[model samples]
Target: MHNAEIAMIGLGVMGKSLALNLVDHGFQVAGFDLNSDNVARAQQEAATLAAMPGKGRFLAAANLTELLAQLATPRVIALSVPAGAVVDQVTDELLAAGLQPEDIVIDTGNSLWTDTEVRERRYQGKLRFFSTAVSGGEAGARHGPSLMASGDPSAWQYVKPMWHAIAAKVDADGMPVGPFDDGEACAAYLGPAGAGHYVKMVHNGIEYADMQLICEVYHYLSEVLAMPAADIGQVFARWNQGVLNSYLMEISADILQTRDPETDRPFVEVVLDKAGQKGTGLWTAVNSLQEGTPAPTIAQAVFARAMSSQKTQRITAASLFKAQAKSASVPDREAVLDDLHDALYCAKLAVYAQGFDLLKTTSERQGWQLDFAAIAKIWRAGCIIRAIFLQQVTAAYQQNPALENLLFAEHFRTELAERATGWRSAVANAALQGVPMPGIGSALSYFDALRCAVLPANLLQAQRDYFGSHTYSRTDQPEADKFHLTWNATPRVQQAQ
Candidate 1:
């Protein structure tokens, strides 16, 4: 019977789990993959997991023709293939597979938002193309994930029920306390054409900054404080109970506690320091620059990753620098730890501020009506950066939708004020001890520069004008009235000895 409510292509880790998740939510799911083995494996997984209190049908289609044949009319299909060229290939294949103009297609991968925009325009009137950025990785797909959807409103409406059913739920306090009667789904309609993916890109950028902050703390604990990895895990565990609570922080603690089976030492100790990325963070950084937004925290995180890649150069430099430096010193251990925690909190606020600023600029530039509150709400669960802190973000936007920057929110401003002393103390101490704290350090600088009403940029503009005849705006005149001055008044003549 061709009564399958929805179809999913690409039965890889995320795809298969999402298919099963739909099935568990009582939606008849038809799934297909290019590899026959993958199809068989997905079928087996669905069967094993379907035993748990679900009454939906699951169909495994051997090919695209079979998959479409099983789906109901006005078909809804989701693609989970690798982003970039593969997505275009799949869409072309679907068109070739006799998909009607009325049918809908959803791309739920890490495709660049601009690429999504182009795809939407390409498929306009030919087929309804949608982009929904899924977060929370494998575990989220298997259970529930945060869904950010964009493109056609009709497409969003068609998938709304399924999205809500399979998305993570948040409690009244905006914490992920698991699915329950009194909770909200972590999914929303972001806007048209690329808005959803753009938001997801910002999420990944903030993730990079957040991760670097955690690593900096870990570095301080290990190198400066002489704490063992297991003990450092305890510090993270304690922090997770406070305002610094987050899924990433919790997992970081868990990772530090894990013992390497071979040597029976903490797994983190044996792991290499080099970091790898999948481009989204870099996209966010580049987009920030394009938008003329200051996202130094995110940019610094990307630089940190790149710097870590030069292991040999850094090792030699460390030895060379060691000879010129005095031994690192610290105040009371507990006091330093307390200050570091507050500094981390302050830096985290800066990172998220920069990310949201990028989103705000992008929304204005692209004409997408993005709801910051809704974005924050959806991120309260399932997504990698989910935290109790996002509840504060939701509240900030709710209090003032027109809030220009997150740091301008009264609550956050007060929080920063209360923690300013400790934050400064931590930064000063780290700098004095020759410990690198790029994430927090960059955040502090960004915040200070953001709040400064006067800056040295006027001199920069004058220098530009002197060198290249670039116009400079006067402080006493309207900014639109550009002025330029000739720095060298001497008449041009050939120099002679």
Candidate 2:
């Protein structure tokens, strides 16, 4: 126990599971929690693992001082605490408890990337501050999870071996290599300071878009096509075996088929409709705006969640505004489904494109030098957004690291071109039928806008100039040269300083 390799603070579900995972990988762990019961439970699980051959032990520490004493010199401690002030509190407490210089602290919470940056600078002289954004929830923690590590390269040197051992592994083809398969670890050094957390934020943003798009597809199938939950589940199961295969889609299919034991209704139908978010998606949308990057699909997904929360208002509005008249003729169900699958695939491309573009823009602005291909490769498994589609994304980046947008990739470009007609038809049909398809519709709009060379922005600029005197740059003139119009004067336009 005195030779414990690492210490884990906050033995909640994620913390405890991760501690056990390290023990399973034969790393001695010293675990502590504010809740004594949590520490006891983790100790019991660790004891069970230690009983097995080739497993390491877990030392339960009573306090911060004891936790530090159990670890070796230059201790490596991981905090699974809630993000924000609590993290700072723990760090300060550790400092007060005789945590020495050169000791490494890893924050494994869903922290804002900027906060990570602040902490790194705040803790610079006292100790090494590192952050690793962990994804895949509790189960993934107990077995394996995608790890995005950043901050303090020296600290990473000490932490890398353990992180890699416990991280989810993937095959050469970008498919998840399960426990039995031989594959490389999903962990990698993303960049400096807040790079890892920023990547994780963007990952959550894409996840929001992905889930909403799937839900919108489900809504179309259930409401417009008159399909039962189980029937829709079957459709999703079929899709899961194809190009759209993903962890989200696979679970979504399973969820749709589940029954509520109490009322004998579909599990989804029994559950409340209001969605919950923990701010990462909103952060991504906000960051995109600040960076001047267009991420309409991601923004629309966040908006859809917000709209879902207004259940009472929606119910009242539904009563006041009668439903639109049904279409004169019902669409062919199979044809619609085919179109939907294509539409979903195309929209997914847009969603990923936006997420990656945001990452690239932020990386350039922040000097993170993030490896887009590596990010895509790691995401192919052990994450909420894991999908076969990411394999293509990985190849796209590997083929050309400077890929401006995912839509421009040859593989994705061909897919989008081939599926554009069906994608458009599905969206048009959804609109005509009065079905809301915000995620899908916004993605299509984004795609169309990107492809258009000339937009209505010229008039927009003119209007801005007319009202606000904001100067406009002309296509004929150098972009750096600006012009203003005096609409009331005889001369319509004049050069501006």
Q: Each candidate's TM vs. the true structure?
A: 0.96, 0.97
Off by over 4 Å in 2: 491-497
Return the lDDT, model 2, position 279.
97
Sequence-dependent TM-score of model 1: 0.96
Compose the digit string of candidate 1's lDDT tens values, residues 46-99: 787677775576798877788889988789999999999999999889888888
lDDT, candidate 2, 434-453, per-residue tens = 88999999999999999999
Tell me, by TM-score, which candidate is best: 2
lDDT minimum window of 10 residues, candidate 2: 322-331
RMSD of 1: 3.2
Each candidate: RMSD to true structure?
Answer: 3.2, 3.1
Model 2's TM-score against the true structure: 0.97
Query: Candidate 2 — what's its lDDT?
Result: 0.93
